[model samples]
Target chain A: MDLKVEHEMHKRRFSRNAGLGFVLVGLVVLVFGITIVKVRMIGNVPEAYNAAAGLPTAEAGE
Target chain B: MSDMSADKSITSGFENEAGFSDYYALLKPRVMSLVVFTAFVGLMVAPVPVHPFLAFVSILFIALGGGASGALNMWYDHDIDAKMKRTMNRPIPAGKVTKEEAFGLGCALSGISCILLALTANIFAGLFLAFTIFFYVVIYTMWLKRLTPQNIVIGGAAGAFPPMIGWAVATGGVSIESVLMFMITFMWTPPHFWSLALFTKTDYADADVPMLTVTHGREATRKHIFAYTLPLAVVTLGIAATSIGGWSYLIVSIILNALFIRGGWQILRRDDAAAEADDYKAERSYFKLSLLYLFLHFSALLLEAALKSFGWGGF
Candidate 1:
């Protein structure tokens, strides 16, 4: 009976730790996903860069 | 007998006081989601490639910054939140957490996030993060929120800076792409928020928030939404046409813009009486759709970048 009670307590502790672990993992994944999205969309392209740099464009605003 | 039972229930509510989960509820998860999405989009689109570990740190700090802003906003707006039905059950208003605790948490998190960003990333990114926290907490929450109908319009800049910050984290400098991304969010804010304001005008009125709908009427708000959305569609298409975006993105942009414009037009065409009659379901649907629209648009950009990196497409 003593051994069985100890085993149950260990299992409960393991389960609680596992739940906390999952929360930490979820938060990390959420942050990583956000980072990946932001990294994919920075800087001007060749066409727009040229237009902005005034590369003899006839377009009045350009 | 009924009065005694009601009194007992009320007393039991205090006896069984809510806990941490209730306090967490005040962070406004929906607004946080947009902050997360735009900030992520900024980090992804930058020219610089950050190491996986540092990337993780930067994004974590950004999320903390966003949460800190939300906490500070809640702390300051507790009184107004108490009066609004939508916000009545928030941590401060619901008496789950004291305003002082919220303020302290917000300040601590803000400082920690900014310092962490500076340590892990570049100074420019750190400065941007610090500014974003200051702008949201001071300029928006403390000043603009109750003072002007253009609260969202001007205050939206705070929310718009995250992508640029992300870009700076990667590149260690600002560029046109970051500015464009900033513009996209800046323009989208008014229309997205005004739609909610249209549906919840009474809540703003009760809180004395000078939202466009409350100050200028629903018709004017709708017109402004349409006006902003038209230019927004143009900008979205323009960004897609640029080198960073490819064919896949252009296709997605066209489709998304069409849907966005349609939603904006529907909002504009509906009269106030018609909108109010159906509990502003049309306006609410448009608002929800706008959220997904931005997510899908940015995801498409990510997809394009991935495809290009694999040498699957031409620039």
Candidate 2:
């Protein structure tokens, strides 16, 4: 015989907690997307730096 | 007596337990929409291109920054808000959210939005967002609102910063086009707000906030509104000559400015006695027009930018 009952406070707070959860999750997704874009757009590195780092460059590779 | 006490306790309990909507109300979402739209236009019209995702993030952060400032403003102005009929039902005054919660939320979001915006866009965009929040919270809300009749004039600069910040997010700096966009909003705020002040009657005076209508006489406020429309029209039209402005913007500006100038003229021509007799119909309609006026102008600029993307947008 389970006698567990939800408290009134818990019911009232559910919406706020859910909203905060959604916002946090959305923020995480946005940060992940930004990270991916930033990593992929690293081609702006100067030719000299790329050469020094032993990375291929358009001018040098040709 | 027992029943009355029970009812009071129940109501108090409900009020004390704020829902998510009450928290959202603190952000003044209506104002945030304007911030978001203008900021989007600023980003789109810039000569430089931004990645679609980055642009979305920049606008989101800018809106967050605007909302954070709004929360801070509500926290500080809760006292005045409680007094005014227009604001008495806000989250704070209505006893839904506490002042400390609002302050904490505002500060946290402000810092996070500014820092993340800088990381996502550029240092200039981040710093500009911070400055805009500071200007709205500190300069406009705390310092000038209660102290001066020119409150809207100076405070308008805070609202006008969004487009400039958007431009910075794209180009990482300002330009004539962005400056012109900022000026359009800046010059338009006085007439837009003063017209509202005219119809709302004693909202400002009742709150003890020194709006132009409170400090200056009603006739003076009217004259100022009309006087402002001239310069507002100039700034609105001036943007059409810039790089981002095009045939669409030019036609929109001409028609809107003509209607705006006519609206201002109608407002200026009416006396208070006549206005009150007609239930402030002229003033009320003028305020309504101001809303459409701003929306259309920005929409036209956005349209021009969209066209230019396909190699047909600008002159």
Candidate 3:
């Protein structure tokens, strides 16, 4: 049985994989960008994060 | 051999060979474009401005949500889709994507979009996106689509929510302007669809879907198309009086609404014989106009909002 490795189905499978890779990368970029914007908007450590880190809350520090 | 032939290969028997574009087609990209446009208009027209990046993200998620709903619609309606010539070549009906794949994709995208939109915008906007999906998938697709002649009338609500959801993304709640935007699309759907039905005479009938033309006689559908234009005119024109309204919007609405009403009247006056003789020319023209009608109205609103930014817009 001579099985072909470079069939048209292989091309479609590669395209689908490539598309999924691009989509995942795009999602990561979007999420990172959103996080940066959120952090910039706050301009300080969020109270929950501060509390979680065992640091003074924003109000307490103020 | 070509992929078409390769799809029948012995080794491919166990593996699904659907492509990326097939999955994308499940999203109904054409419909997503309308959702994106309307949602962007809604976001821009809100009194509260959104950050440009946030605005982009919100609109993208809204489009995704809309697309997700389209996928679910396709999944549920693949049977009828197979029957309709317009939809016979859809991913599922064409045998590219299975109905289960479409359903899974729809569910996953719906959840992702709603959650991301909420995290990007606000909870209300996120919740609104989820509700819009539920309305489209469950209410419109599963329940109303096959059961009622008024399917699109009520199902139209699902399509209309994008702009409102966009407004919510900015304002974090519904307002008169957003409701007005919703009404414009809502009232416009019947006439738009019925006109297409007038021309495509057999699609709905053959599919056993209860479209207006299928349930009601041609004359009744014609009359309904004209009647809807009246309210559609009122809503499109009425929005001009609100804060989003301006000279640009006002003038555009008046001209467009007048032409729309005239088009409806033309549709109403024509008989089946006249339409057939002319290859349904009037009906076809009316359908084309209906497409522009919603788009131009929203564009005018966006223009009004843009002018307001420069301190020159609104009443």
Candidate 4:
């Protein structure tokens, strides 16, 4: 009698849908983390490029 | 849920069929890359410098906004894609992705990108992102794409909005410099896409889409190509006189414009028999060159910015 092991039989398995879901989950998590940071307003005030008159400065624009 | 899986063609094949790459295609990565680069340049040459981490996050959301536009465009244009030979192999037409899945993906990403942008950047940048997405989907894709030969003309405004959105990321307001960049892309769109129309007019004709070439014939389209490129050159030279331009920028602009004009002339001189015999090679070459043309112009502008940073006479 000859028999194949269950682990051997499943060695090459791959599921595209699951892989896609995993990738999407990772992306969503990344985006979510960035959103939290931005929402909390945790960063330095950006510096203006020019010191000219008659235009909206960075802070004023914000 | 059972009904969704049962209809397989219209629903997400989340258990098996839809692969990672299929989802990626829905984002239109090629278009997204252009959005990212242009947005990055907009931020880089802006009148303010964002915090480094904030800058990265801002561009990431901008890219997501661009991807959302692509997904929504693909969702709406699936039928048009099915009819056109050039687009027939896209995810939806090829059965690799479903319309409902694409639609949901687009809506989700659009909200995520915009909300996060507002939270991270300023409300102006976030609102700009939201408006760009709305314009591309509602105004451009749903309304203009199939209604008129002038569709791409008006629709091009959606594409031109990215740099302005990017500029807002840093400065939180519009400027003449940002508007000039937007104009550069806006004016370039018709001729760039029309060059494509000259050779692939049959594709638009077959799909019942009113591209300029399909509506006006090749002669009229050829004339439009030269007409548009001339003004594009003028707009490009005008931008060179701005603070962002430099000696190197001027040199690149002149050479590119000369070649562009010659390319347009080549298309104008082609007869039906000649175009058919040569497989529209000249027109196709012009189309390919037009792609490089915008990229090089933007890259030259960035180079000017870098040189100016080093006190090399950009202003």
Candidate 5:
């Protein structure tokens, strides 16, 4: 009975480690994604976006 | 007594063998990358600008739809996949995952991606994606894959739909640019698969998939490749003439198609006995180059779109 309980505990610990690994990878991807989005939104569109959309040449809104 | 333990050993072996990675492999990430890149170009080239986050979300769902198609394809094709030496090691055929699990995953992802795309992008984008998934899984995999030698030719629409869906996400409608993008991919698929079939017909034959090479012979398949590349060259030029293209794109298209046609001609002109003896070098090189051809065309389009957006190139 004691051996069986230790084996079960070991399985639980392995699963916990796997769960942590997944979360770590997800966090890294999320960070990278946020960085890319920020870089793309640097207000450099200016009036170029407006002229293209035919929205009366002005700064791109949003 | 031994039978139960033997069964447990088999079951436990598979249980440990299948993991998160095996499930991800079922998504066919290489195929998904092509879908994502083409769809990204479509979205980028559209006249309307989608917010970065929204663009990301739209592409995420599109890739998910593609993955759903792949899982369903694996589920349905597992039998033939097991027979084909090239595909015998896929998730299902390798016994890492069950067909029922793949089916469930596909169905779930299909529903989630379709509904989430509708919520995130326009209804038209969502509908097109849903249709793409259904066409790949049912029209291509279920009915046509086993039935026709021209399966890739007709069913190529499934891959071609991604750019159209991406365009719809931005503009909520199709235009000459999006349709031309679709046409480029559509016309390119036959030669692509046929080139592969030239080298791998044995796999198709063993699986009874009736590929062009299996049905018509390698010589005829080579002739078909040469024929298809002719119009494919013209279609590439046709895309360059659209509003989304410019001189740079036109130049790239011309050069790429010239090399492509030259490659096709070499494959068509290769001495069959020599190829048989030497392991089909011409066919293999042509197959590898064909992979680069579509990507270069789309990349050139992306360059044009970038230039035009920055108030410089085009016309």
Candidate 6:
């Protein structure tokens, strides 16, 4: 009975720590995903802005 | 009977043996994430465009610099970490990694990041990176952490520098936008961190670290939290109004600041007994919320910049 209780407590502790780890990893992924998406999306805007300003787009070939 | 008990103890202890994951915990990846995001925002908002290759290099160096600071912070605080329940499981105290290893990793990464920044970007950005490492490792970790309750208030400047470094990487010089980015972070650090300190007073006190809660008492810390938070909200909104940010950012800023102020006000109203009774759950939740608040605010700025470039609403 004592052995079983000890094992159960250990399992609980492990699960708790693992849960915290998952939460942290989730937060990191959320921030990283947002950053990458925003960067890629915004990255092309400068070119579009230039094009709209009547300047030849850099990739449009001279 | 005795032999059986001994075997049981040994096996149980082995089961709890910590490893690399524990060491990684000491690096404070969540804080590092904010540093990287804000730095990326600064890089994106700069007037000059950096080559994609160079931008990648700059962000990489900034992240490494952040990790180096974390490792060094753990190395210096290992003694206290052992005492604090919150930090007692950290690698050094838990015997997962040696202090020497952490120190070596910190030193190696710091040197590599600084030199790489100089090579890939400009000397100005590299210099800022080196100064940030020095400030966090030497000034904050070695000196201020043990010496004063105000350690984080000043030490927080180290984390605030990444955006400036990112800006420098792009423009090769500092400008008002970079300064505004720095100001937003500089003001935000005190309230965000001190709230955690307020809730974790026992751990800090046990560790012999003079956090505000330990030095000034919970009531005083609560007052200070609200005080710093008011200015922080103002700075956050102020940054949104600048040329680097636009309407989407301003709207996000206003909403986030209102929520942050409400949280801070809630913290101020709670007494030490009430805070302790809830296991500091309120403060902990608020701290978590603050992290998301800053991330969203910066992300909004990036969104606004994108909107402007597409000939949409620039204001």
Q: Pick the candidate with the highest TM-score.
A: 2
Q: Which residue ranges in model 3 land beyond 4 Å of their true spot?
A: A1-4, A46-62, B1-9, B12-16
Off by over 4 Å in 4: A1-62, B1-16
Model 2 misses residue B203 by how many Å?
Answer: 2.5
Best-to-worst order by TM-score is: 2, 3, 5, 4, 1, 6
Candidate 3: residue B221 lDDT (0-100): 94
Interface DockQ per candidate: 0.03, 0.40, 0.38, 0.15, 0.08, 0.05
Q: Ten consecutive residues with minimal summed lDDT in candidate 2 chain A?
A: A1-10
Clashes of each: 16, 2, 0, 1, 0, 0
The per-prediction CA RMSD against the true structure, in angstroms, equals: 11.9, 3.1, 3.5, 7.8, 7.0, 9.4
Give me candidate 2's TM-score against the actual structure.
0.92
Tens digits of per-residue lDDT for model 4 on B131-151? 999999999899888898989
Tens digits of lDDT, candidate 3, B188-250: 888888888788746777888887776788999999999999988888888998988988999
| Residues B34-66 of candidate 5: C-alpha lDDT, one tens digit per residue | 999999999999989998877887898899899
- Note the Cα lDDT for every prediction shown: 0.79, 0.91, 0.89, 0.83, 0.84, 0.80
Model 2 interface RMSD, in angstroms?
A: 6.0
The ten-residue window of minimal lDDT in model 5 chain A covers: A1-10
Which model scores highest in DockQ?
A: 2
Rounded to one decimal, what is candidate 1's iRMSD? 13.1
**Arrange candidates by DockQ, highest first: which order?**
2, 3, 4, 5, 6, 1
Q: Write the per-residue lDDT of candidate 4 for residues A1-62, one digit (tens) a residue.
A: 23333321133134455675686796777668766665556344333333244566677777
Best by lDDT: 2
Task: Provide the TM-score of chain A alone for each candidate, in the order shown.
Answer: 0.53, 0.58, 0.64, 0.40, 0.56, 0.59
The local lDDT score (0 to 100) that residue B186 gets in candidate 4 is 92
lDDT of 3 at B94: 86
Tens-place lDDT digits, model 2, residues B43-150? 998989999999999999999999999999999999999998889999999888999999999999999999999999999999999999999999999999899999
